[model samples]
Target: MSQDPPRIVIAGAGHAGGSAAAFLRQYGWKGAIVLVGEEPNAPYQRPPLSKAWLKGEATAESLALRPARFYAQQTIELRLGTRVGALDRTARQVTLSDGAVLGYDRLILALGARPRALPLPGAELAGVKALRGIADADALQAALGPGRRLAVIGGGYIGLEVAASARALGAEAVVIEREARVLARVAGHTLSAFLAAQHWAHGVEILTDAQVAAIEGEAGAARAVLLADGRRIPCDAVLVGIGAVPNSELAEAAGLDCAGGIVVDLAARSSDPAIYAIGDCTHRPLPLYGRSGRLESVPNAIEQAKQAAADICGRPPPSPEVPWFWSDQFDLRLQMAGLAFAAHEVVVRGTPDAPGFAVFHLDAEHRVLAVEAVNAPADFMAGRLLVAKQARVPPATLRDTTQPLRGITI
Candidate 1:
């Protein structure tokens, strides 16, 4: 008699989980694959939730990574609206929310992250929301309209994006950031200043170093935001976009090593060889920087998925790519490649007042550390290549836009 094929169970059917399934099949894995998700909808791209989707520029069907028929055609089992209650590491089994237990020869945890909630008073009031899923997007969209007011309680990407969308819908938008500058945590001062100015030019009020004491509401519906300085900003809705907390509870319960996120190796393997973690849920080492950190970008998710698939199939993983992220606000397209936090010098390639510009971050040795491109796709792409190759270039050449970026590489 022929032996039964091994079974692989994936938890969290988001980008990471869904991509892992598809890649596994592509890698010729004939095993029984099952993907379990807490959300009812199929896997969809999330970046659009705050921009295009919120602006009514994209449809629900257009957001899906793959059609429903694709899963059936690939013979991949999808358990939508299902949750994994617990993991039995010893037995290599997972108990579903409905009390059904499934065994797996290999397990992948792609349990992404959730929006961090504000613990302020009146936070639970209606009309106060956080955008994380499609449902949250729908709620926020309904609240945005002409003559309405939206107070965003963070200066992060989501908050800024939502503020832009609200403004586009003719709603008065205000961004309250506790830091000294908007995007202080992720972006450098140059990019931060540019974005702040962009929002201001678009008539969206931005208050940096502003603290929210509480969300004041009446009849359980948000009416205004109270600041630490005793000033009140009246609003019809409030969006809390402080950040996200990784959903690594299941991994922790399963006895996997976890810190800010589940600790995984470059191969996306956890402490246990049979188990792997990927996407925003894993804090893996960055070969480029020789440091370990958690990345919350779609490219990181897809790359990690491919790595996990390779590891599970006993194949060599693909070459590691430099980390990159993008944001769309108004007509500005911000693309950042690599981490700019530790750069010693920043070189501006184009005039910020113009329609296009790029910021290149370099170390003492003039090695390209990161690049922030505003409406400069060519610069962003070249910067990504240089960062991945660890190329060092002359600062003067980088600053000269008239010179071709590819020829100036050192």
Candidate 2:
């Protein structure tokens, strides 16, 4: 109770909420910050929910982004398990489900996203589970055991990770995808091909172009899944990794501009300057991507929250941080710097068959657009700088294993 410095109300205590609170404190904004979340627990890392947590390789304590002491030490008030029922933009207040009305000078919505489910029949069967929150991960984990059969729906990151984890636990894992290949939408053909090989090496059964008709169960317990291809696969549990839709219903109901997600400006402020949204819940126009887009990645969450915090604290904007992301599957550590689309030309600097290699993408102007590195942090770091400076690396040397990737300079 340090005299309640400039009241701020933050909704949805996910990664964005935690990051914004931490940033505010780091920037010396000694204001009263109230982080309100519908979930009973403080903000924890959700990416692990589908990976290590599902495999029981990580625990609730380890998954926590920041400790409970973090908020306590910073004097940031956290109201957990409290749902924000209503928001009045004019009155600058939020009405909690508990019937508590809170007034704020500024508001930040970091509500994040929700997993999308299929509309087919029997979607409510006991085996049907979406991998998003902690509770969902716990339920899925409980179903994993020796000889257990897991039919993982969708061939995205979550499904593949879960499949691997289940296999490690001695469970028969089957991945059924509606697409021709796994992760066709997110990664390029090369990465997808690599991952498919890795999963195959681990003895995971993958069914591509598979359309599941229904989940068959007995006595309200999961038994098997019926596919549209007239194939039935027995299973003890089903993990749906189709995709996620941003949690923008509250903003949409409140009449905020929402396209793919709640539309925000470069500053992370919504159409209404007093209100701001960050993380997966925002379709912010990114100059780096050349247009407005919504990216569902941790890098976007952390960076956008920083921008929102700076704006709230009345500080001049910081430099636009170059976007970066990583994914871990088995022993391969994949890192990406900058954004790359199909138009970009991809050339391998190191041999693809090598234990460690880098794939560099360049534009027509010979400027580095992006780079994907496997177990190559130096290449990743250099790629980050190249994207930031829009630098050029000689085409032959970029692919030459003779020179260190960091030495790749124009």
Candidate 3:
């Protein structure tokens, strides 16, 4: 008699979990695979939630990562609208919210993350929402229309994206940032200033160095936002987009190493060899950054999923990747590569007025560290290659728009 293959169970059916299931099949895994998710919908692309989906340009069905038939045909058991309640490492089993326990020889935790919520008063008021899942987008989209006003509570990518989308839908939008400038924690000052100017030109009001004291409401519905500076901005709705927190509670409860996120190695293996974790829920080492951190991008999730799949299949893992991210606001397309934190200097290529530019962040040794490209795809691609190679280039050469980035020979 032939022996049965090991059972593989994946928690959190998001991008990472879905990818792992597909890749496992691609890599010739004949074992029984089960994917568990809290949401009713199947796996879908999240990048569209704040952009095309919010603007009503894309349908919910269009956002699916794979068609429903794909999952059925692949023989991948999908447990939708089901949550993993607890994990018993000793028994190598996970108990679901329905009180059903599923045994697994190998387990993958792609739990992802949740949007950080504001603890201020009136936070639970109607018309106040955070954009993370499709349900949130649906509620926000229904609230947006002509003559409506939206007050965004953060100046980060999600906040700004929603603000732009609100304006595109003929709604008045305002952005509030506690810091002196927008994107203070992510992009450099140059990119931040350029984005602020663009949003202002598009009729989006941006308030910096501003703090939200409370979200005042009437009859359990959001009415206006009260600022710390004694100013009240009337709005019909509010969006809280400060950031997100990793969904590492399952790993932590299981007694696995977790610190803001589940700690993992390059192979995506957690403390236990029988388990692995990936996506935004993991704090793994980055070779290029020379440190450990959590990356919240689609590319990172896909890459980590592939690594974990390979390790589970006893195949060679792919090479490490340099971190990258992208954002779309109105007509602007921003692509970034590498970590620019602690850079010595920034070199600007192209003019910001032309609405096409790339900012190169270099260390004191002139080594390319990071690149922020706005409407400059060529520069972004070249910069990614250069940053991966740790190539050194003169600041003057980067500042010259006439010089082709490909010819820099980095």
Candidate 4:
């Protein structure tokens, strides 16, 4: 008698988990694949939730990473709208919230993160929202329109993007950031200033170094934001885009090593060899930076998915790519490559006042550490390569506009 095929059970069917299922089959996994998700809908693109999707530029169907038929065609079983209640590591089984249990030979955990709550008084008010999924986006969209006021309680990419979208919808927006400047944590000073100016030019008020004390609500809805300095800014709604908290509780319960997120190696393998973790839930190895951290981006999720698939299929590992991220706010397209943790020098490739520009961060030895490109695709591409190769280039060579960026890599 022939033996039954091994079963691979994937928890949390978000972008990372969905992609892992597809890649597993493509990379030669002759096993039973089961993808389980908490969301009722199929996997969809999330970056556009604050930009194109909010602006009514993209449809629900368009956001689908893969059509519903694709899963069936691939013989991949999708168990949507159900949670992975418990993991039995010893038995290699997972109990679902719907009272179903699945036994697996291998497991992949892609439990993504949730939007961090405001933690202010009235944060639970009806009109105070956080954009993390389709439901949140829909609620926010309904609250925005002409003559409405939106008080954003963060200066990060999601907050800024939503503020821009509100402005486009003819709503008044005020961004309240506790930091000294917008994008302070993720971007360089130059990029921060430029983005701040852009939002200001678009008529979105930006408050830097301003801390929010509490959210004041009228009846059951958020009506205004109270500042720490006793300033009250009235608004029709509030959006708290402070950050995200990784959903690693399940992994932790399963006895997986976790810190900030589920700790995983380059192959997305957790402490347990039979189980792996990926996406925002994993504190993954960043080989380019000689460090490990949780990266909450689509690119990072896809990259880790590929890593897990290759490892499971016993194929040659894929080359490590430089970490990259992008944001679309107002008329700006910001693409960044690598991390700028210990940079010692900053170089400007183009004039900031111009239509396009790039900021390059370099270490003491002038090695390309990171690049922030504003509507500069060529610079982003070249910078990504330089970061991956860890190439050291002179500051003057990078600043020279006459030389081609790709050719100056030497």
Candidate 5:
């Protein structure tokens, strides 16, 4: 009698899960590969959803990470419009939403995060939306056009990107932020101020230090945002981009360790060695920062996919990647690397008002902790290397545009 081949089951077909399945094949995993997702479409790029897709510049086909035929060619089973309903750790099996029971030798949890909905009254109105999937993007895109007024409830990257896209579509945009400045939680003051100026230059109204008391609606559709200070800002639609919460309930129910997200090791392994977790769903170890945190970015997703693949294939692990992120707003291309939480001193490479500039965050030891480059690819590349190398350069040298970043090392 021939023995059955070992099967690997992947839950969630987002970037991380899709990449994991591809990497497993590349890393010589000949066993059965089943990639399951709740959505009807295959894995696709998400960054463009808030920008190009919303602006009607990109199509659904353009956002795909891989074509529909890739899975068939690779012998990987693609299960679309299906979700893993229940996980049995003891039996090493999962119950699908379609009432199918599938057993696996190993399971990969790549369940991504969902938008954090607002708690204010009238938040569930027809015109109030949050973008996390293609359906949401389509709905939000329809809400934007010439003469439309979009009131963004958060000043984060998604909200700002939508605001920029709305402006490009000849619509009016207003950003409401509770913080003292835009991008306060994720970026340094220099970059935030510069971005604010760029948005203002593009005719996007920004209101900072503002609190939303409720979302007023007319006939079950959002009509205006009411502020705690009695200010009523009328809008055609409302977009809430505050943040996201990890889809870790399934993992938590299966008795896996979960904090803000699923707690995972460097190898993306969960509490149960037979199960691994990756992407935005995992609160993974950040070796560079000497801590653990959740990183919601494409780079982070791909990195964890590689990690999980290597472990399963008995291949050598890939080197830890420097955490990085990017955003597109107006005509600006912002790229950032590393964490700036513990930085003591900040250095600027070029004038903020200039077309190209880089903001560097350094610890007390003058070690480069993070870098934010706006339309400055050279600075972003060099800063990434410096951060990975943990290089220390004098703050004055960093401020000197004449001193090449590639040559500056102390």
Candidate 6:
């Protein structure tokens, strides 16, 4: 008798979940694939949500990762608007919010993350929102208008992006960050300086180290922002993008090892071999970073999903790939393809003031750790291979604009 095809269930049809399902089908997984999502619509890309979507440059229809017909054609079951509440490992069944149970031989937890709420007065006002979900985006979009004021409650990536978009729409943007510098949590000192300058040059009123005490509004709509320092700034809209918390409630309730996120191995498999996790909700070991930390990037989600899909098909063990990230801000296209923190000294190669240059970060031993380039995709690509091999290059040579970036490799 021939063995039956495996029944696979994937929770959260966002970046990682949807990609894994499509990948499994591409890998020739002749099995039943069920993708469960809490949202009412199909999976979509999130990178452009704050910029293009906010600026009316991209519509909701253009955001779809794959057409609805694609999933149908691939024979992948779509369980949109369905929430998976619990996982029963021993029984190999999942409990949903609607009290239905789904049995699966292999499970993928792509639960993703929930937006971090800014706890302050006026936060519950109608005009205050977070940008983690489609519903949140729609609410914020409806609140935007010409001559309106938009107060952003954080200075992180999402907040900065929103501030830029709001300003472009002719709305007054006031960014209140509790840190001494903008983007303090994610970037190093130099990068933070550059990003802050970028925002300031674009006419964003950035207030670092300012704590918002309350959100002031009338009739449940935001009107102004009150700081702990007793200063109130007039505004019509507010966006809180402090950070995000992993959506690991289902896994934690079911006794999965979770710390900040669902703990997973190199193959993106959770503590329970049968259940694998990926995306922002996972606290798996990242080999490329030379550390184990929760990475909340879209690239991390997609790559981990691809690896998990391969593993589900009984393929060879896949190790974590080189971590890569990018940010599309205004006319600047910043590209980073490896671990930026593994460096001690940074060499600025090319024109620094010209908005197009390559910054090479070297380790204590002077080995190529990472590279940050603006409008220099070629250097970033070559820098990835250099970091992978741990090359030791001369900082002075890297700074010279005359030589091709690749020729200056250590």
- What residue pairs clash in candidate 3, if any at all? none
How much is 258 displaced in model 6, in angstroms? 1.0
Per-residue lDDT tens digits for candidate 2, residues 1-410, read 01255778899898888888889888878768889998888988987776678777897789898987988999999989997788888788889999998888778999898888878777788878888789988888889989789998899877887888788778889999999999887766666777788788888888998999988899887788899978999999888888999989889888899998999987799987889999999998767657778888888899898899888778887677667777776677788887775335777766676437777778876778788788888888887888888786767878777777666645
Q: What is the lDDT of residue 355 in candidate 6?
A: 71
TM-score, per-candidate, Cα-based: 0.98, 0.95, 0.98, 0.98, 0.98, 0.95
In order of lDDT, best first, we have: 5, 3, 4, 1, 6, 2
Q: How far is candidate 6 from the true structure (C-alpha RMSD, Å)?
A: 2.1
The residue pairs found clashing in candidate 6 are 121-215, 393-410
lDDT, model 6 = 0.84
- The residue pairs in collision within model 2 are 349-399
Q: Give me candidate 3's TM-score against the actual structure.
A: 0.98
Residues 1-410 of candidate 5 have per-residue lDDT tens digits of: 11168899999999999999999999999999999999999999999999988888898889998988999999999888999999999888999999998899889999999999899899999999999889899999888889889999999999999999999989999999999999989999999999999999999999999999999999999999999999999999999999999999999999999999999999999999989999999999999889999999999999999999999999999999999999998888999999997899999999899669999999999999999999999999999999998889889989989978888744
Best by lDDT: 5
lDDT string, candidate 4, 198-317, tens digits: 889999999998999999888998998999999999999999999999999999998899999999999999999999999999998888888889899999999999999999999998
Runs of candidate 2 exceeding 4 Å displacement: 1-4
Better of 1 and 2 by TM-score: 1
Q: Cα lDDT of all candidates, in order?
A: 0.92, 0.83, 0.93, 0.92, 0.94, 0.84
Tens digit of lDDT per residue, candidate 1, span 1-410? Answer: 11267899999899999999999999989899999999999899999999999999999899999998999999999898988899998888899998888899999999999999899998999999998889999999999999999999999999999999999999999999999999998998888999999999999999988999999999889999999999999999999999999999998988899999999988999999889999999999898988999999999999999999998887888889899999999998999999864688999999886658999999888889899999999999998888988888989989988887977646
How well does model 1 score by local distance difference test? 0.92
Comparison by lDDT, 1 against 2, better one: 1
